[model samples]
Target: MIRVKDIITRINSSSISRRMGQGLVWSFTGTALAKFLTLLVGIICAHILQKEAYGEFSMVRSTINMFIVLGSAGLGVTSTKYIAEYREKQADKIPAVYAATNYFGLLMAIITAILILLGAPFIANNILHHPSIVLPVRVGAVLLFFSIINGVQNGALMGFENFKAIAINTLLGSVLESVLTIFGAYYFGVNGAILGFGMGFILIFVTNHLSINKNFSAIHIKKLSIKKLHLKDFSILYTYSLPAALSALLITPSFWLIRSILVRAEGFQELAVFEAADQWKVIILFVPTAFSQIVLPILSSLHKEKTSFVSTLKYNMLIVGVTALLLSVGVMLFGGFIMRLYGATYDNSVPVQILAISTIFSALANVLEMAVYSLGKMWQCFAINIVWALLMVGCSYYLCMRGEGANGLSMAVLISYVVSFLMFLVYTIIVVRKEVK
Candidate 1:
């Protein structure tokens, strides 16, 4: 018979649980503080900028993020998955792997950045339908390049489980970005705000580079050899990263399209309200997002241990699902007060409450998605994301057309995620059964 004390001792002695505890502590601390600063910056910007300008700022940022998928090309998860799986087994090949990822990431970044630069005016005029904001979109192009490289670097660190370094860097980067963005918005309005965001990404890229260098030395990877990268070195990119990248291609553009539909159907005022409520969604998810990040590397390491992997995945879903429910309830209870932070223009509570409820489904889907990633089933993941993205875009476009405004868009999110959670649930159960057998 097992006693409570024995259970406690066993948990404490478990290597995976101990590492997870340490990672969560640092991840929560840094992510919470960083997201708080981000929220603060948004509030200040909303108060200072006109509603239309704030809307434009939000739109430009979204467009940049859409393009960012091209540059990132799923390399972030690719790096994390491979590095975590291979570090102990193939320590000597770590440098080659790192070098190969960087080379491909850099090439993609250059191509995507140039594409954005050349196409900004067309995007502003044709897609966004606000040609006056062309320069801001151009500025976002620069941000895209640095942001992609930063994702790769951060992914490498996560693979190594260097949560302490990630936490410190995240804190410092958030502080710098908050100061610069606020200053820029104060002086030059929309364009300056976008420029400030670009500068922040540059700083993050440099700091991450420094951290990765030190991590390499600590892990006894003496050198990263770009010169020796061969065809085999790039197999991960084709096998895993391509499907992951294609999945992002479907999802990110769908979001940009959804926002575009809302903006065109209802205009910037409605978009501002949507963006305002969306900030809270970001805040509530940030904690769970941290948990997901920690779960990925740990799960990747346990991929060969089917029973432990299934147990870990179940535990993660329970924790994240419960936490999401509590946070959603809290947000609903304080909906009006939270919306008021963005000032009177965003005082509507319906959208906030609607998005709050959506968080529960999003949380569950995230855990299942992580399991797919850990098992290296990128094609299956992409297939699921296709359904997810299509539902989101279709529902949002239809609702926005029906004149429900921001509230409609929020409802679309809730609906899409509900279906997605069920789909992921069925798929994950099948996968787990097979693995356990």
Candidate 2:
């Protein structure tokens, strides 16, 4: 206990420690509220809608989430990285980061929304064979635009370490969205729920954007003026943004592939069951994810100076390791009771158990992935994700087609995540060795 206290004291006294701690505190508050609301919204909709209708709702919300990631083009990450780096060394370039994020994120958001709107028909009818969801898909696309802009706002704010604003914005948006979703689902059913859920993005983006802009005077018309944004500025911003975007592009689509496999192979019921169980996985990842968000900007700065970050990384990994151990055991024990909460229909705990087991691998993968991101190994990270996504889709497709149903899909994903975790761990070790020497 004394040794642990000393180590804690040392960590708290470090330069980046306050920033990381504040980030975690604020991020955890916001994340807890947002995810709790999400869980509530899921329960409300599950109670309100039919099983099939609830499944469609989950699918649409998931799709909008994926599309926003694609549309933002990893500019959020790029902005965070460059802003932190520039703030430390070249303050003059900070404006360019802000300018590029505002204009470029908006452009990408618009394009992404349009694509989702236009592609809705083809996706619902041709690919998904769920024509009734066509209009709902379009409705959800509204969130895509707002979500990207929120990403832009939050990215810059994160770089600036404005957690108070981020926390407030995230919590309010989620609360409003949850409130609206409950009302809408009760009055309007599945489609209304989809559109109402999108409202959260709108609320969060607008409020957060305003807060950030005020905090940093981020939208300086002078710096953003057409003449000031030289080609070099664009080149620099795009150069960093592109790799991150490519990584998101490669990764986000896998969500749809996973959903589509369950939908086509079995039916909406299977998808709903998997979705419910998967929410547990979200719970397991949430805290580590919050830590990762806080660490990224700090890591970005440290990496810029070529400082040794292995200690920080180790501490972060240690937190997740203990969490993984406890959660893995808890899930093994309480898997059935958890599924029971989703109502009487979700009786089978097998999928939940499988996903619970997978969370251990997923948690480790997440930490390693963040380490690589901190090292600015986006290209190497992208290669691993490409392989992971390919393996996931191909194996999931084959297994689902084997008529083994959602169980098989779960097993396939479990195996794939395990393999990916091993690869990421090995990759991070090798990279850290080279960096150390």
Point to the candidate with the largest lDDT.
Answer: 1
Output the lDDT of residue 230, model 1. Answer: 79
lDDT by residue (66-88, candidate 1, tens digit) is 88876889998888988888888
* Model 2: per-residue Cα lDDT over 1-437, one tens digit each: 22545445556667767778788898887878899889878877888996899999998888888888888888887777777777756767888778877788889899988998999999899888899999889998877788888888888888877787888888998898998898889999888898788888888878886776675565342346655787777774556677778878877779687888889989889999888888887877777677778777777777633333665666677777678768777876898898888889988888878877887788878888877776778888888888888888888898889886777777777887898899999999899778643
RMSD of each candidate relative to the true structure: 2.2, 2.6
| CA lDDT of every candidate | 0.86, 0.80
Off by more than 4 A, model 2: 1-10, 217-223, 304-308
lDDT of 1 at 294: 83
Q: Provide the global lDDT of candidate 1 against the true structure.
A: 0.86
Q: Give the Å error, residue 182, model 1.
A: 0.8
